[model samples]
Target: MSPDLLLNQENALPWTERLNFARDIARGMEYLHERNIYHRDLTSRNCLLRELPNNSRQAVVADFGLARVVQVEPNTQPDSPRKMSVVGSAYWMAPEMMRGEVYNKKVDVFSFGITLCEMIARVHADPDDLPRTNSFGLDVEHFRQKCEDCPPAFLQLAERCCDLDPSVRPWFSDIVSITTAIIQELDSAPNGKYDITSRGSSIRRRQ
Candidate 1:
């Protein structure tokens, strides 16, 4: 498991770098889904970061243990199971998967959204670990959600990704576009500042 960003970076990465990591994961998911590949187990622990110069990190999606190809089988039955047995880490598991309902690549989108919370908070995505909502779903924009440490744009996209209805979740392709736009906006801004929680950053939330 990735205990923290960069595998073992003593200091927490800047907010922009964390956002870059999020983008890289989104691109990786887009690549897999484009070819009908389903990464059944998507989580921060499965994602590896290759350190680059100047504190930048390249996020690589690893651990394909539960990966499945959603290809049509010649002799498959119409109702054959497509990994509906509730696989993946419990924390990152999607609602459909948790309910043991038929699911698809959209499950990964849900995991991605939860992973965003992990990225922002540097904490586990388990329920009530951090400030959350009474709603049964992950809603970063919820009035009670304490995701203020994360970027508003990132939080908004994560909210969409975590929609309880799989059909409402955006595809990894759409996620790529949104992350690209966010990175662009960050770059174009004049000396932008962000809330960096913990790890001796400029912003720290005292308990």
Candidate 2:
């Protein structure tokens, strides 16, 4: 098990760890998507961690029990992917998935958003609190009131991942670009360290 993944503690997760925790998963998912494979179950537990000597964790996406390979062109519908029962974890399900509508790989983006929320909160998620109905994704209000301690850009990425319109969600390729930018910015900061426990001072809203 990945110690870095354990969030049920007294202190906030180190800010860098948030990006570190998610970076590889995004990469792995991106790679899978490039090959037209999507993991239907994308919870945190599906990720395996390699603990480094320096205590940092390296994430590997695992458990392909419900995965599917669709060889179709972009923005073009593939064969039916609908299932009889609601698939995926309840807490991380996209709003469309929750409503039993058609879903696609963008569902993984939604799950990533909730998974990031769990990482920030340092506890198991409360499904009731996840975005619902027409209000999918974190708005500026959720950012200021609920996730002030998380990196604004990081949470912003999550927010974009959770957009109600999957068309609006960034691809895994974009997810990779965003995380790389965050790591670069933090690496250039004074002392090159971000205090995970500190509340975020500013947020870059998505335009």
Candidate 3:
């Protein structure tokens, strides 16, 4: 019953709407981390967006059925050696979760990377487009193009978010910093417009 499921129906949104949707999702996850809550389930289906009366957007993390409170005991192991439960969608699950290994908040970071990629894909492809088969199989070309007129810092931050090593992933605070910086730059850009032609040319060169 999440609002994301309701809003993200087939053929439901235009590309610009999808972009704003992804931004709000990133903000919601950042908020969760600010409160020290790890939303173990961060798939697209679990994010709900609410429209404010001021014509702005807000999002919330929903479906906490798989969420866990991260313990902060230094060098302490679970009292029972039982394997941690594996939950969440297969495509979005971090490698450690798939292996049933005990992990910390970084697992959620990994899943966020996947979610970011999925959101980027939705910006270019039809809603009915098939899911990608692998991480690298994502449409980096499309993303790079859309970001062509965007500040370079924004594209770099998005790439860093998808880094393979969880240890290297940016913390929520870092994400907030980068996102805020980029938003400022975007706001200051002429007409809040980007050069899609340059983006398309860049994609062609890469291909």
The prediction achieving the highest TM-score against the true structure is 1
Of the pair 1 and 2, which is ahead by lDDT? 1
On lDDT, the leading prediction is 1
After superposition on all CA atoms, what RMSD does each candidate show versus the true structure? 5.1, 4.8, 6.4
Q: Which ten residues in a row have the lowest lDDT in candidate 1?
A: 198-207
In order of listing, the candidates' clash counts read 0, 2, 0
Provide the TM-score for each candidate, comma-separated: 0.79, 0.78, 0.66
Q: Which stretches of candidate 1 lie over 4 Å from their true place?
A: 6-10, 53-55, 73-83, 130-136, 139-145, 191-207
- How big is the positional error of residue 17 in model 3, measured in Å on the Cα after superposition? 6.4
Model 3 poorest 10 in a row by lDDT: 198-207
Q: Please give, for residues 1-207, the per-residue lDDT of candidate 2 as tens digits.
A: 243545545444565666877888999998988787878788888888888999767888898987888667677666334443467777677777788887778888888877776665554545454334445444445444566656668777877776778888888888888988997777665444453225323223332
Against the hidden true structure, what lDDT does model 2 obtain?
0.69
How do these models rank on TM-score, best leading?
1, 2, 3
Candidate 3 Cα errors over 4 Å, as ranges: 1-23, 74-83, 123-152, 191-193, 196-207
Compose the digit string of candidate 3's lDDT tens values, residues 96-188: 676777656666666666555555433312223423334432344545654443345645655566555566778766776666665554444
lDDT of 1 by residue, 104-161 (tens): 8898998998888777666677675633444446755442255455567777887788
